[model samples]
Target: MKRIALLGMPNTGKSTLFNRMTGGAARVGNWPGITVELLSGKILLGGDMVEIIDLPGIYDLHGFSDDEQVVRHFLHDNVPDLALVILNATQIERQMSLLLQLKRLNLNVVVLLNMADEAKKYGITIDSKKMAEMLDMPVFLLSGKYGAGYPEALQAVARALRYPTPGMAEQLRSQLEEDAHLESEMARVLHHAVQIPVQMPEHLSDKLDRVMLHPWAGLPLFFGIMYLLFQGIFLLGQPLQLWVGDALGWLRGAALEPAVGWLPAIVQGLLLDGLYNGVATVAAFVPLIILFFLFMAMVEDSGYLSRAAFLMDALMAKMGLDGRGFVMLLMGFGCNVPALMGTRVMRSRSLRLLTMLIIPFSLCSARLQVFVFITAALFSPVAAPLVLFSLYLSSFAAAILTALLFKGKYQNNEPFVLELPPYRFPTLRQMLLRGWQEVSHFLRRATQFIVAGVVLVWLLTNLPPAAAPGGPDTFAGMIGSLLHPLFAPVGIDEQLTIALIFGFVAKEIVIGALAVIYGQFGDALGSALAQQLDWVQAYSFMLFTLIYTPCLSAIATLRNEAKSTGFAAFVIVWSLALAWLVSFLFYQTARALGY
Candidate 1:
């Protein structure tokens, strides 16, 4: 099979193009030695199967970032027969630089000036034939979104496969002989062949960026946006959460309660109470996850995300990080696994490490259940949102402080170069598709990790203690005892400590453990806990869960990205220690205030 690679800079519609070509069947996996996932698919061309690999979006191959290195190694080692270089037509000047570098590799190359429709609106026009001659390869103008010029682009690929031109190196070297002359030649050709009208609408992005990136107004704007996003998540999710809860209760009483009666008591409890409730809790968050993704997708597609990054650059620089790192932090709100993987966008090793270390602090969707359940039960409805916001603020503050501390020791900083794509209205099809994808992922987690977690929590909490004295004497009680003292200063009881410990395996399991534990003691557990556990203790539990160890998948990804078990181990240990300390301080301070 012939091999082809799709290469481009970030957000240049590479994934869109990949989806267009492969019908979204590409297998995605982390590239060797990098956290950024690579996408690959096989396309039939001219009655022959051709493998297409979508490389990570990168600006230049000279960088040391994992993404850059991944591309560099693939180009050097696999050496694809053809490289389909996808460039954003609107940003030709900067995009062309990568194409120039790729030309030096001497691969059969085809240039795809994607997003041609948007480029034309920007008064940017590229003469395909002229570009082809300039680069000594075929050029196809494509609008992947609209499926324009797709057939021609595919034909160009097939032609390249048949002809297999190996003249790119010589062509590139020749162009370098007279840099000014070469540019003039290309410009003259473009002027004659390409006609872009001057009349166009105002770039709405520029107008928005002016205010969104303003020093004084930017921070408030960001906070407002975040507040609205969470408000929508909470408000929209509440109905669904309640509905799911009621449905689960009905199912448990009407069906599961009677169905499991013939089974042993332990087996009955594990299935009816543990597994069933765990899946229900995770399912309840589906609405919130969908809402969060919709909000992010709107921001991203509207081109505000880049402006947000630009506004954050200076603040991030104070911590030896770049504005791009902020994007990863933002992603953590949706899911930490992707957020951790997003650190590949950060070029500096130290910055990547620091960002990864702090990402767990960002309240991931998995932890939203813990927050909502606890706050809704303990605080007023109005106070619940405020309490959740405070926890989010704490996480953000902790991340910034951690970054600053790391900067003091390792001060390498990379420039945050980003392309602010022109703002446009989002298509309904795209929004719904993206939103559905996130919701599907949430449901999958419910079935895979959450279901099993519920069963385990049910078993642990229901199983009789090897020695009987108190709650701490049970199987889970014993395990909780081992880890409980570390959280004593944080006001976390043995039961909560056990939940926290299990959270490292999978965050969704925390809620399941709590459900089983609280349900096991029935009325006694709640009344006794209410008397013993003060508001400070509740606050401390929330804080600790927010900042503590990441989910198991995140740890595995860290190991893959950092390429060192030691680094992953350090991250796990460090996050646990910091969470404990921060929670302890919060509890102590709250107590001192007589809360």
Candidate 2:
């Protein structure tokens, strides 16, 4: 299949366009010999199947950022037949320089003035016909968000595919020169093809930014919004979780129990208590995961996520990072594995390593499930969201402390630059797709680890034939007992300690291990947990989970991205020490406070 590359500066609606074009059927894979991931999808154009590769959004073809270098290398090594140079219509005046850079590389390019609708809203207009004539290429006014002129855009691509641009890839490395007059050339093109209102009416984005980005109120408002997000997730997801739990219970009783009833006692125990109870317990949190991702998608697609980063840049700099690192940290909220991968955007090794260290501290959705379960079981409904929000705050606190402590060792000299797109309403389809992707990723990446961890926990709690399950003589009990003294100061009991051990594989398994530990599932598991520990112990356990070692997948990604086993090991060790220290202090202080 012929290859077409989607290239654009960051926040130019490149990803939105990719999703629109590919219908969210894109698959992410690494570029050859490079650790950077590229999203590719196939679509038929004019009876020909062509692949669309969404390259990393970069500001310049020759910029020093990791993404920019990746783009340059990919173009040189595997040049696409056509590069769709997407430019944000509202910012075309400035973004046109990137297009000039690509042209200098001798790549066959089609200029897509994306977000035409938003441009019109800003009292800006682009004459695509004039632009096409001026730039000697096809220029199409398109809105990637709402599919305006989408069919025409595809038709243009189909037409361009017929006339393959030869010698374009070969010229990439040799022809890339410092275009000193590129600014004047872009100005010449824009002067003819674009019009901007001198007295442009104030936009809703501007009106909102005045307050949302205000130095005094921005940080507090960001936190308030995040707090509400958690509250909303709990309020909306609690009943759904209950329903899922009940459904799982009914399935176990109605189908699984009968299906496995004829098996031997040992086999039944493994299948039912080990697998069903464990997997089902974790599966019950799926609703919250979906809701959380959806909320994050809204924040992201609305363009406020970048604003959050901008708002935090000052504070982040103090912690040896920037707004961009904080954005990756926020992405870690969805999953640390990808967030760790995202650190590749930083050019400096120290910056990437520091960001990698801090990202794992994000209370990912996996840990979110554990916190949601614990908070629901221990705290009142009114206090549950508060408790969950506190965990999030603590996660950031842990990340900040880590950055401050390690800033000297891992120094970042690179400057921070980020694009803040205009605020717009996120389409329902986009939000749903984000939720689906996150939930699907959670299930696909987590199922094996969760099942294995829970089964191991089950075996550890049920082995030796003569001992009672989860009793002192069982393997789990023995291990947990051995470590109970060390954990006791932090409010972790033997059973919870066993769960923590399994949790190292994947945090979702923490809930599953708990199910196995208590010899219960669904509502019974929650009730069992409530009986096992008070609110203070439960909170302490959450703090420990929040700061403890990241999952195996995250550790592996850290090793790969940091490219140093020693650094990865240090991360694990430091996180472990921090977890113990924080939990011990919190438990001791809470006890001292007579709570």
Candidate 3:
């Protein structure tokens, strides 16, 4: 199999092109770096199994960083038959530097002019054939996001790989080895191979960025954007969330509820109450997950996400991260899996790890749901929003504190530099596909873990033949009793403890599991919770839930992104200790003040 390495500077649509080529069939593995991984896939192109390797995006391969070194070493050690370099066509002048550098590595090269549509709107036109002639490589003008010109490019690469040849890599290297004029030579090629209108069309992105990238106005605008984002998540996701639960309920009552009566009580408990309920619990939140991702994908596709980072670079630098890491942290509000993956945008290992660690504190929509449920149930309508707002503030505080503590400890040498792409309108197809991809990845990774957790909780709550579900005689009850003295200071009890145990599976499941533990449902469940716990304890429990742990999927991501099980375990321990300390202090201080 001939291997074609996909190389590019970051944010050139390399990953999108890779996904299109691989049909979303990809596997990830760490090479030498603990923070980032190599993405590889096998595709049957032109009746041959071609391995498509998506190498980490680096501006200059000769630059230092885990990603730079990783790609550099991979090229030297395991030579690819061909290199397909994706470049942002809007900024071809600066992007061509990497193409020139690749020729120095003596590898066969093909230039992919991505985002051609955006470039065209800027009155930029490129002569692909002429550019290919001057650069001594194949240049394909296409938009990776829209599936434009892909089939022809793939076929060309397949044919080139099938019929080996001594290409211009050697000839160019000999001419430019020590010439130190790669930039001038690149400018010369663009001079003949491209044309631009004397008076360019007024770019829409520049007008938007003028306000969005403004130091004074940008922060407030960003906050407004986020405020609206939450409003959408709640307005759109909540009703669908309820519909999902109602649908699951209807299915249970109409189908499984009757069938379970015929099975042995134990089997019924395992299936209906345990496995089915557990899976359904997480499944109910699917609407929120999809809506959140849909909105995020829109922001990402419009290229506003990069601008958000560029706007926050200076403020974020104090915490030992760049605008990109902060952008990843902001993404954590939607989902942590993609947020962890987003850390790939940062080239430094330390920056990626620090960003990943802070994401668990992003007050993700899942956790937000739990906070909303508790605050609404415990506080008056006038106060509930304030209470929820405070919890969100707490999440941000914790994230910033975590970043400060870890920033200097694992500092890396690479300075953050990002190119802001022109913003374009997000297509419906792109939004839907991006949303589905994230939701599917979340379901695939989280379902089994959640089901197993549900069963484990069911067993602990219903063992010994006499103990009622979540009763005082079961193993969970006993464990809670033993640990209550320590937690009692923070107003924790067996029921809340059991909910927390399941909450570790997924934060959104906390409310559903609480309903199970209390044997209550619908509006009655809130009243039951309010009766069982006072407002102070209720708020404390919510705090503990918010800070204590990342969901199971996040833990798995931490392991993958951090590249060590030990680091993942450390996150668990650190979060648990911090949650305990924070909640204890909050409760104790409130009590001291007679709240």
My TM-score estimates for the predictions, one after another, are 0.86, 0.96, 0.86
Rank the candidate models, highest TM-score first: 2, 3, 1
- In model 3, the runs with Cα more than 4 Å from the true position are 1-3, 22-36, 39-44, 47-51, 76-82, 104-108, 164-185, 196-202, 337-357, 365-369, 372-390, 404-414, 502-516, 519-536, 551-573, 588-595
Between prediction 1 and prediction 3, the one with superior lDDT is 3
The residue-level lDDT of candidate 2 at 264 comes to: 99
Better of 2 and 3 by lDDT: 2
State which candidate has the highest lDDT: 2
The clash numbers for all candidates, in the given order, read: 0, 0, 0
Model 1 lDDT tens row, 344-381 = 77767777787787787788877887787677656677
Model 1 bad stretches (over 4 Å): 1-4, 20-26, 30-36, 41-52, 61-64, 79-82, 103-110, 129-138, 146-202, 439-448, 465-470, 520-535
lDDT of 3 by residue, 496-537 (tens): 888887788877667667655665443456678889988989
For residue 352, give model 3's deviation from the true position in Å.
5.3
Which portions of model 2 show Cα errors greater than 4 Å? 165-171, 174-178
